[model samples]
Target: EGRRRGSRAEGGAAFETARCPLPPAVPDLLGRDAELARLRAEAAADAPGGVVVSIVGHPGVGKTTLAVSAAHELASRYPDGSLAVDLRGTDDRPLSPRAALEQLLGALGLPARQIPASEPEQSQLFRSLLAGRRVLVLLDNAADEAQVRPLIAAAPGCLTLITCRRALAGLETARWVWLDPLEAPAAADLLSVIVGPDRVLAEPEAATELVALCGNLPLAVRIAGNRLATRPNWSIAYLAGQLRDERTRLSSLSAGDLQVRSAFEMSYGLLSPSARRVFRRLAAIPGSGFGPELAGVAAGMSAAEVQVRLDELVDVNLVQAAVIPGRYQLHDLLRIFAGERLEAEEEAAERSARSEELLSYLLRTATIAGRAFDPPVLTAHPFASLDEAAEWLYREASNWRAAQRRAAAAGRHREVVDLAIAMHWYSDGRTQQQPWDEIFALGAESARALGSRREEAALLNFLGWARYFCLGDNEGGRAAHEAALALAVEIGDRTEQAWANASLGSVLTRMGRPEEALEHARRAVDLSGDLPFWLGQGSIRNVLGTILRVLGRPGEALEVHRGLLADIEKHYDEAHPFARRFFHSATLQCIGLAQNETGDWPRAAETFRRARELFGEGGNALEEADAALNEGRARREAGQYEAAAECLRAALRGFTGVAAWWPRARALAELSTVHWLTGDAAAARRYRDEALALCEELGTPQARALACELA
Candidate 1:
């Protein structure tokens, strides 16, 4: 009958139904009757509205098999024919959204030359073709939400069924059906269907154990069944016992070319050499997931190139896209398989070289990102925009931080010290009360290992600031700074000595030793005077001014800030707007704090407003929020309740968005006070409770004290 139909079609080419390009119907799909029935019901119920059913599961739970079975059963009902595409959601070369659309349009009888190149235009034409037609579109193995969203049947009287490892959370309209491993009864039934039912019934208990040993997963079961069917003499009990060992389970599941490892290898083999290297080395990443930028550094490739490879990996199901947009992860089993490949395929020296490349990239790139937060020095800025720098710092935090540990293990002491030196100022604000204490401690150890007194002194100086500001360990901070001062004096590094003195002054002030703090602040200023270090003088003076304000000497603090502002303006260059804005904004914020302390409410508010503008332009969200917080406090002091609440709310939003916990807590506390002043007791209590919870969670003494005061 098929031969007669082929001959007739050849004679009457015009009468053939344009050859629906659906793949051959799946030969046998056992124990999925309910799933198929659900799809049929959805397709029938969703007439004229269009139905999109997503069959999501882990690797090889038979997603493609189930979709194909449903398509074959429901094809006759849709008179307009069906279209099936292997979007290769898990392929190394997944089809692009645009290309997928073009293929679908071509299947709909559109000519190649007439199809639009742009995605939007192609989508419009596709929807037009699908309109008023009861066609079924089966999109198998979707890579991510973005890849499948465009292919969804746009008009009613159609159905689009997609299968993928990920949940594709971004696809809002699609009804999701999550598939797990088959149950014991169903698993045995499937095994029987594949390898003769009589053979399975002959040893029922052994068949049940065999299915369980296969993890009740359809793919494993099918392979096991195929292997047994070919070897007619092999007993079911013998095969089940062979797969009992966990280590050799993957090996035992395979018979010929049909293998779990081979399916994984097919995806891996399609990768470019660079991408393959990245995929295998990714086993070294300690966490479950990572972004492409970090993967790029590990692979020694550009971020753009790594992103394309990541898309390919996602398409083939070797990697899964995370809920966080840029992050990707491997399944636990796949991760182990990748590690096996890395050990077998890569030499020890090659692995070490890859580690070195990753470490060096992290140290260099992190230093560049970190320096963007510092007051302008004479050094060239590595990043073109502060926004780019901030994003890099946030997104790649895990990669660079992990690299620091790896560097320490490899004895790359000098790079470790230099990396931490760059983070000195940036860490103070960005990670205040975060885990920067351990980072600085590592830097100090690295410096000591190199036997460089100057580097040791510098690391110790930064370590003191981290202990005092971030860890709230005043004793540790004083001890570290004193050691740094001793080392600097012994080495005749006057610049480092001055920086150490300035750091000690800040620590002593926080420790309630005002007179001692004043002495150190004066020495820091005196020592910095003759230093040729570009940022030294202003850095020490800023510390001096801050101490004076802390000691109730606001008038002197104001004078010192005014002098520091003038010096910054004197050196400011119009061509280097980042440097200019960086210096000016910090100075303005300090001046605002000084004015607020002196009871000059209006001047403080105005200064804070100007600082906020500069920080906003520079893309310093944390600093911008700081200015807003200060302005809110000044307005509150002036009894401008409404204005104060508005400023505090804006500050809270910014701080919350960036996850700056300590400052977010502070903003919440301040906002509570503003609400209290405005007689909104409910709002005040709500904000106060949030602040108290955050303070308690962090276990910071200063934050706790502030929270108590609010209570």
Candidate 2:
């Protein structure tokens, strides 16, 4: 340790002796072992002049702590001395490069009179002093590249470590290390360090919850830990329960001077007015992640303008760029802070207007995207292609779904009904029925409230399909379809009547009542006769063919399905490719079923394969899985056990990926059969056990049948 000593220059001005003034390394530096090791390695690496390492991250992310810790660890490598200084970059009054040079000169043993007044002269003198000597300089809380540029020591054997909240992209020669919030394990370990290990061990679940509530941020965890430590009477669970309130979370994460909010405020204060406005307005959006387009719509800015503003926010770590390109998200705590700022800075009316605008935009865009799957109802929209429309619908689902809820709450029933109606055909391709259940239920209620029986019947038909196919609730589906048919007949809405009859026929067929299903299916085809194939007639015919096959009329079912395919080909247009593919795949699967019933296993396998490919092209994961299941069944009937097992496994994967528990259970049963036939007794038993468990949970007729078979 080089101790400071009083010295006088030739001109009689006194200065303190050059000394290693680095602060003591943090005793419990958790969650930064890899970062510290990398810093040490870089410091020890060979360089012509010196190495400059810049540690960058958001405020309260422990950038300065890491820099200081690394400096202390590598202190012995530099024989001359180590120096540390705080630039106070986030303050209203940041230290200038010239003033920073004055401090560094004093620290380097220069007398006050000998230190040059000009920045360039001082920089040159500082470099000259450290020319041949190995010294470590730690510049903490830097404002920008400009403030840090002059302070860099260019002498050989001198190492400089700089830390800042923002990335100093303008700094050319420095190696950069980015810091993110601590991972859960490391963050919990840090919390355990501050609060006693025994206390954390006693309430492990609360400790995990506490860290997650802190967003695994190091400073928040430290403050929370310190608060728990000071109040010996407070349990970890008690403290966690207190932090659960978002309104008071920031205020709660405080111990003495360590406050998460104050650290965030410093970063927030540095943003431009426009950037700040965008930042706060973003909190009004309903989802965690969004793109520039949504941000632009919310902020009332153009795409270009919002992109520039978003870049500005990302520079300061206020917003993070998502792994998916063109997407960004604010940190959980930052989002809360932004929401607080929005309420504080914006008027009530202005905030309401902004939120309403975003909601309206989301709902309108969603309606347009959903319409891409329904070709006959063409409307002017932003999307250029079906793929783009599908992407937007799935990617922005949370936002649009939130908008639907808001619209319902605000009594905007027409808008809610319109969005739900558009999602009718679109929901068929989605992975789960839960979202569709909520959407169609709200739509049906809104339609009922508005006295629009036709819309209500249509929405109820959709709800029925979701219940029967997606949810595997035959009774619920039959009830919905019956209600929808009653409403449709009362309103003389033939289209809705056709949909209701078709849905009811499918549900009845699944309930092992094909004789009753045949009557409803034929009536659906008749009711849909005036409509085009892509509209409703093709689906009705497919239902009719399926009922015929189930009732032991495979020859008639084959003719019906072939005729339906011919009708589709005759009326197909390239403009409505998704609708065409969807209908074509549906017809092919019916044809495959008829073929399977007629003992044409090879033809059925080929037809199912084609249907699976078509469904895949239409982005219908559930339908594709259905085709695979059918193909596996056909292959098994043909005595192709190995091929059938592969097909069943593929079907299982598709079902599991979409969380379609009923279909997954069905696939598991099919796999068990194939495994049993192939002499894999253990695998067969395992598959049967899983299928029975799923069936026991589902409590559906099909599940009960499968369970009986497994038993």
Candidate 3:
């Protein structure tokens, strides 16, 4: 890092290059002979006077020791005494310029009365005193640029060295140096200092192994070395005993005057109690990053208070202030510490209850916001907290999933049994709502946990329908529906009973069991009237239309769709919250198909157009594509050749799956007629073959006839 950034100073005492001293005593920095030589050379060169050098890296990386060593080596060149200030940049009470300069001036034997009161006057006085006298100013544990800037003595004879846990890039005058982990040989050398050089030299392999376990962090290694240095009776192999235990691995980093936690605790203890409380709770948050809004939620504090606490944590190096914007995270080491404290500091039962409440709050919020996203239903247990609930779900989607997973793993069977019930809207909202797979797995797990035939049956039935219709997973669709049917029979829940019947009917229809599917649809309709109208009435009626159309009873299907359409129009406006949902759009598509099958081509075209418009509103690519295919089919049958050509081109662009391909092929065959009628035989022939291939591929006899006619 020194070579990367430091400019080489010309001849003269490099220490005259104006360096700062670190604290009075610092040991355990060894094996940087080549590194120290480079720094010493830069310090000697007089290319630029008043140069500020900063030492920066992760904690326990030996930045202070290197800076302090350089400061002591440079002491002889400066007749005036060197000054060391613990700026505490990452800690609370970043040493203010007034306090630091007062200490520096007083240390040099200047009377307290002689020092100026304000920051500017004191800065000038300090510079005046050090003007001709060569001095080294080592600002140790410096916080940030704002803390260190005022303390810079403006004399060419004074060299300034600042050490911090972070790169003080904000200080324009500072040359940056990074204190990375000591290398293996260097760490071994550091270990030698604790256990004598000869002992480490004898067991180089063990020494190498020890450093690897240390993560090459100076703080952790020093603790290991200290254990060996003080306890001569403890063998190197015996020290390795404690190291083998994962639980107590970081324990080695604990001892008198040198502990990672103690260092952390000292900084933590300095915080206001409120900040400490917020600090620990922040660990309970699930994501790797969080916004201030989430921090506000986790702390149950005001936005202003959360920001203040965040700043406090950043100042003390407990939390890193997110550099991008509106985010924060604990460092890995600090995260471990904070997590441990969260569990230990709070009663286990109390923490567990709070976690449950937080998870319930998230589930309730997600369901509400999801409903509001399109208000498709008034589920029996609709969420009460609307606005606040929506806001929370929008913020903590990931946390809710993590919580759901954690609950399931802990054998909290009840939680597992019903987590997906809380998140029902996830699958219902369609594939665009990402987190669908997670919601499905959670709901399935919850059903497994409950082992209640009724709940399991309902979940299986509903989840199966969603997978088949939305995700288009045929195997999952079949298995889930089968499970629902068997469980519904076992539970005897009439609503789920009818739902299971309808679910099997649809999957069976997709599997080409039209006759059997027609029987199930009939059974679903028979059971529908005894249940709630909204629960299965609309669905069963649609199923009836589907079966009738398959039986070539277009007249009956058209009549069913017409009546359902009237009910929808009479009870709800176009902007009715639920009417705007994708479910309503799907119903509209069935209505359009019924009309087209019954020979009301104009009405079919209009209904398809309306459905397409509705899907477009939500940017639902899949729905819009299906609607385009239907509108094209209606246009083709209406003998609107030019219009049909336009519609089919759009359908091809928008359609996705098998259903779409069949309609699109029919439209293509019709469009070839348009070409043949317009005296473009070559274009007609090309389109005819394309349509034939699609028909053969999809096994559409009706479309194949049109292709053959065009040929």
**Candidate 2 lDDT:** 0.78
**Alpha carbon lDDT of each predicted model:** 0.73, 0.78, 0.63
Clashes of each: 8, 0, 15
Tens digit of per-residue lDDT, candidate 3, span 109-164: 44333233345545654664565666778887777787788787557767888888
In the range 47-158, model 1's lDDT, one tens digit per residue, is: 4548888998876687888888888889888888788766756544366677677567656654333344356645655665566778888998789998987888867888
Q: Which ten residues in a row have the lowest lDDT in candidate 3?
A: 1-10
Pairs that clash in candidate 2: none
- Alpha-carbon error at 577 in model 1, in Å? 3.4
- What TM-score would every model get versus the actual structure? 0.58, 0.58, 0.53
Which candidate would rank higher by TM-score, 2 or 3? 2
lDDT for each residue of candidate 2 in 1-711, tens digit (9 for 90 to 100): 000000111111122324327756787888898899889889988787699999998777788779988988898998788887667576434666866776677666543333443456456556656767888899888999989998997777889999888889898878888998888999899999998999999999999988877777777777677667867898988877767765554444434222476445545666799999999999888864799999998898988899999998887667888645799876555777888899999999999999988999988889888887675654455678776887888678767887898899999999999999888766654524125677889999999999988889988987887666655578998999999999999989898788788877888988889888889888888898776656667778878888898899999999999998898878877436766786788789889989988899999999999999998897677678889999999999899998899899999887665445677898999999999999999999999999998788667677898899889
TM-score for candidate 3: 0.53
Q: Model 1, which residues run further than 4 Å from truth?
A: 1-184, 189-281, 284-317, 323-327, 345-396, 422-429, 432-435, 531-534, 574-576, 592-711
- When summed lDDT is taken over every stretch of 10 residues in candidate 2, the lowest stretch is 1-10
Error of 2 at 518 (Å): 3.0
